[model samples]
Target: MSAKTIMIQGTASHVGKSVLVAALCRIFKQDGYRVAPFKSQNMALNSFVTRDGGEMGRAQVVQAEAAGLEPSVDMNPILLKPTGHASSQVVVLGKPVGNLSAMGYHTDYAPKALAIIEGALNRLLAANDMVVIEGAGSPAEVNLQEHEIVNMRIARMAQAPVLLVADIDKGGALASVVGTLELIAPDDRARVRGIIINKFRGDISLFQPAVKFLEEKTGKPVIGVVPYFQGFRVQEEDTIPEDRSRAELVEEQGWVDIAVVNLPHISNFTDFDPLEDEPDVRLRYVSKGSNLDEPDLIILPGSKNTIGDLAFLNRSGLAAQIVEFYRRGTPVIGICGGFQMLGRELNDPLHTESEIPRLDGLGLLDTSTTFAPEKITTQVEAEVAGSGLFLCETSDNRINGYEIHMGRTELAPDVRPAFTILVRSGEKVFFPDGAVSPDGLVFGTYIHGIFDSDSFRRRLINTLRRRKGLEPLQASDTLLVHEQRERDFDKLAAVVRSSLAMEKIYGLLGMEGPICHG
Candidate 1:
């Protein structure tokens, strides 16, 4: 049988294209069809390394889980990490090739970009019974329509029927969908097979008229109106700052409140997931305009654009608020770019190279960060600070995580050292990497996945509980929640496998029955 394909295109970014593709992949895989998720390109810092040493966007990683498969770099060929206003770090087929300005990327690399995308498609073609391709941004961006590698062009190249998706929650989704279809060239529009109205909050019955109108006018079927469910298990495609989680609203049960500053370009916030798994603690991701009045602890998460986001934080008054929190004896921690922001000064004078200029840091820690042309990327282990108020309460808990950044930092003489010089490779440990104040209440680290360790996470969470006069939750209870969450996802995939029209979908994917468990 020939490979059949389906594509999910969006009217704009964050419009539920990734989630729709994930659901479809799950449903098709359940019907005994081997399925895989594909995206020609993605612009995100949330990335994961596959077991086979391949890299793919985190969205595809989640979709791969939904499809009962491991992630692969071939699933997402080109990854563009926007580092500044106009500059982006480009990854070609999972490896860092170079950095490019927006115009430079499109004008100089379009031909080669297409070649790499086609190469990734070829890999997906070899592995799966069917493939689901996800489009990037909007298909209707006419200026970018010509050299598009992640949208209709890739769909046409793969010969997949596109499923257009728009978020009803965004308002005027009908017009957005219709307008997107109308704006695209005739050939591109012809590839659309159906449409799905995503994130419908109210009764689906009320939208029947609009759905029918769209189907009638566009001559395309309305496949589904997926309602928003509170417990849905899917990896987020972008940094959604909205207070959508039911888990966040639950009372802490006298547990500690750990508020993490939600930066504009927060990367790998997953570092805090283990802590969220703890039942006795409340992990509140506070976005802009939210009060930081009484957070027992405030965590500054990693950011893709440090200087630019720090500028955002300073302008939004979060910087001053952080200082106030520190003065109040509240534990404030920064990770990666957040660590950089806590320094005395940040020097990025080459405004021609990026958006951030040499700006003053929060100045909580006596340290400074300087940007380098090359990024530091590695996995390592470190021992926590031996002499800090925060460390005094902790036992021997080792930290393990990867570091990815393009800056060098050193502590000022007034501050006590955080982590001792245990190990440093990748050449020249210019300075003692992570920084800690003499008291340990204020600290920063370059590590990305430190909280993945249950013991370390519990120590931090329990500290907050101690400060808040709350009861402590046992570690076993917290891990169980995550186990249940994963099991629920597997169940979700099973449901999709059973309910969808499998045979037709399978036929479209160019695969016959008897899907491999692998």
Candidate 2:
């Protein structure tokens, strides 16, 4: 039997489509169905590396985890990481195709891209009992609809029932939903089986009349009214929430204050989520021109455009501030692009990433980086080669993380290696991964998620605390990152099951009776 498919398209960006897909994936998995999530294309700076050395959008990775499955590049066939305001680095099936502008991508690439999208979708359908598809932006984007492979086109290809989701918290939920349905082509509009009013704040009971009115006017069932859920952490696709301000960090008042230099085109910001979860650590993303506030530890995060963002740091004077902080004996760490920025120079002779031929780095680390044509997207296992300020007290020196970068970093002969890479993509290997200063005050690594290990995070936080003349705090018994996400998946599934009309959804999918086991 062919697998059943359902597509979730949003009225606009960040209308909670990704979260809803994740919730449904968990719900289906709990109901004894082998489920998977798929997106034809995703445009986001945030990304994840699959176990097979493939890179995809972080949202699909979260949804895959929700479905109790490993992430795969097929889940998100095309990922566009924006390098500038108008240009993006396009990845097809986990490999960099080339940088392209919006017109170039749509006019020259969309047709071929659609074939790959369908191929991936078909493969997932063949393997899973159900596949949940999440569309980008809106099908109502009439200007882009002609070449839209992610929304109605995929809906038509799979003949999947569509759920149009609108964020009620942003207001105009009814009009947005109705307007979207009305704007799309009639055949595509007919594919929408239901409407989901998402992010509804205040009393949900008060929204019953509005739901009724919507269903009455559109002849589509208001399948769900999802309340604005808080404290449910999931990996966002592109941008960080604006409400995550420095004020909140100050109020939280953890023992150690860590500032992340948020670059203009920051990628994989979720790399620091584990640190944010630590009770003794206060993590804040300090943008260009923002005050660093004398942070005990400063982090230069991964960026989509390393050279461009490095210039940004220089132009914004954040680079100078970082140097001053390092000189003052405060710990500074760099990851991926940030690691490249910490080196003596960044050379892009082939213009692999940007037009910049060569750019001087902050010179914090005795290393240089050269942009390479082949992008590295692989999982890695490494052990601390030498004890640094952060790794000094870590009980388990072994770390598990992934690498996704476009440059190869070479350290000066006299520089100390930070971590020795043991395995790449599940195979054993031997190589140094990062550089550490003689004083252990500055560190740079190509590895993302280096702080995910609980022992590592705890040790780093406590070490900073000790430097501030504070006693060490007890280690947290909290769940690991993966385990916590599994629990979050269940929590989200439970809420969605209660909020949504499951019977109606099953009816739309042409399934009957309860599939849940317990």
Candidate 3:
């Protein structure tokens, strides 16, 4: 029998549709059902690579994890990573087809993309007991609704009951819900079995009147009003978070100060998410306009456009400041495009990444990068070399990360390799992966999600603790990213369960399941 499905569509982007879908997936899994998450098309910079070398959006990755499944491209059939304001690198079923403009993609490619999306959806439905589908942006975009496969079209195709969500925190949520229902086709509106007001604050009772009005106006029940919650560590597939104040986090004597330079087109920023969970770590994103405070460590994250973002670093003066920090004993590291930006120079012969043919790098490491036409999107296993200044504390040599870039970096003969590649894309490979400076302070690697490994993250934090003369915490039951996420998923499932009308939600599915406590 084909799996049952429910679609979650937002009134607008970032309306908490992704989080809700993940929560529901966890709820279904906890109540004894084989559940999976699906998103027809995702446009985000945050992405993850599967073991078999397929790349998909991180939102579905989180949802898949909630459902107790490994991330795969089948979960998210289409991923569009924005390369510029108007253009994006379109990846169908986890591999890049080509970069296309907004008009080009919608006008010329939507038909083919829709076919691929449906095929993937049918496969997911056949494999799982239930598939929780998440939509992108809004279905009410009248001009684009005809061609947009991410919203109502997929809902109708799957015959999935729709849960329309609106962010009340953004205001006029009632109007948004009513307007969306009115704007969509009558048949599409009929599929919306319920409504949800997400990210609500204050007493939920105070919003009861509005909820009642919403229900009456749309002829649907306001199934839930999810409160604004914190401390739940789910990776977001939206914009970069603003820089935050340290504010005496972790309840410790001191902090492991870290500054991540937020690039214009930063990608896979979830690399630093694990750092924020550290008990004494003060994780901060240093954007272009923000002041770069002196931190124990500085990181340059992956970028979509190496040359353009590197030039941004130059114009913003972050490059010079980062070099100054490295000279002053601060450890610096870069990943992917950021890895290329740390070299002596970057050469784009075929203009694969950017319009500029060549650009000077930060020159922190003794390396040079050359952009190639082919992109590398693969899972990697490596042994961290004990060569970097702060790497002496590494208790674990085996670390795993994914590479998504189009540049090849070569290290100077005198510089040490940061990590030795063991296996790449299921193939055994023996080669250097990254470069470490002579003093072992500045380093750059192609590894994304490197810090997610507990062994590596804890030791790195301990290294910074030693520098500050703070006592190191012994590793006992430290939470790995995977473990922590499982717990968080349970917590999220609990929160959502209590907030929503569970019986009614299951009623919408036309199926009965056990109701378990959070």
Measured with C-alpha atoms, the lDDT of residue 107 in candidate 2 is 85
Please give the CA lDDT of all the candidate structures.
0.75, 0.87, 0.87
Best by TM-score: 3
Q: Model 3 scores what on Cα lDDT?
A: 0.87
Q: Residue-wise lDDT of candidate 1 within 1-518, one digit each (tens)?
A: 24568898988899878877787777666656778899988989787654434445778887887777877788888888777767778877766777788999888886678887887787788777788889988999999987777898898889888878888887988998899999998988988877877777887678889988998989987776766645445668766434433355347466566788988788877677666655565678887899876877889988878887888899999999999888878888899899989989888765522455788999888898888776666555667754565555355756655667778887767676565435443233423557888777888888777776667777677667766776666776565434655665666555444434455455555557555552
Instruction: Kindly list the per-residue Cα lDDT of model 2 for residues 1-518, writing each as its tens digit.
Output: 37999999999999999999999998898889999999999999999898888889999998998998989898999999888878889989998888999999998898889889888988899999889999999899989999888999999898899999999888888999889988998898889999998988887788789988999999999998888887667777776755253333332334678899989888889988887766566678898667998898999999988998998899999999999888888889999999899999999999887788999999999999999888899999998886668656344789899999989999899998889999999898998998988788888899998888777777787788789887776665332676777777888888889999988988988999467664
Give the per-residue Cα lDDT of candidate 2 at 464.
Answer: 89
Candidate 1 yields a Cα-based lDDT of 0.75
Q: List the residue pairs that clash in candidate 2.
A: none
Q: What is the lDDT of residue 304 in candidate 2?
A: 87
- Which digits, one per residue and each the tens of the lDDT, describe model 3 over residues 1-518? 39989999989998999999999999999988889999999999999899988989999999999999989898999999999879999999999999999999998998788789888988888989899999999999999987898988898899999999999888989899999999999999999999988989998788889988887888998998898877777778866765567564655557788999989899989989888876678888898788888899999999999899999999999999998888888999888888888899999999877899999889888798998878788899988874856556344668888998889888887888888889998999987888888888877889897898788888888888888898877666344787788889999999998899988888878887664543
TM-score of candidate 1 relative to the true fold: 0.85
lDDT of 3 at 169: 88
